[model samples]
Target: MLFLVAALLLLGVAMGSVAHAPLPVSLVAAAVIGVWLVVFTVRERHSRRHSS
Candidate 1:
């Protein structure tokens, strides 16, 4: 999960630098991170509930 987020962040940086469009790159990265957080949080909650 961490790896995925890290990869997306790196990709975002690369794309922004290469394309010279920080705004779009930032928006994409923000969306990806937001979705990832929601999914990760839900999975963690489910796991914790099952464990107990």
Candidate 2:
């Protein structure tokens, strides 16, 4: 699932570049995804700690 997301993101960036998406739009996408990843990591760690 993570690999799929990453592959899709790369595909989106490539297609967006080919189709002329604005730079800020791409930056914002990356930023949002970055935040999501950080949050997910934190939650996963917290959950693992509680489980063990």
**Which candidate leads in lDDT?**
2
Estimate, for each residue in 19-47, the C-alpha lDDT of model 1 and write its tens digit.
76577777887799899999999999999
- Write the residue-wise lDDT of candidate 2 on 1-52 in tens digits: 9999999999998887846868888788779989999999999999999999
In TM-score terms, which candidate is top? 2
Local distance difference test values of all predictions, in order: 0.88, 0.90
Count of clashing residue pairs in every prediction: 0, 0
Off by over 4 Å in 2: 1-19
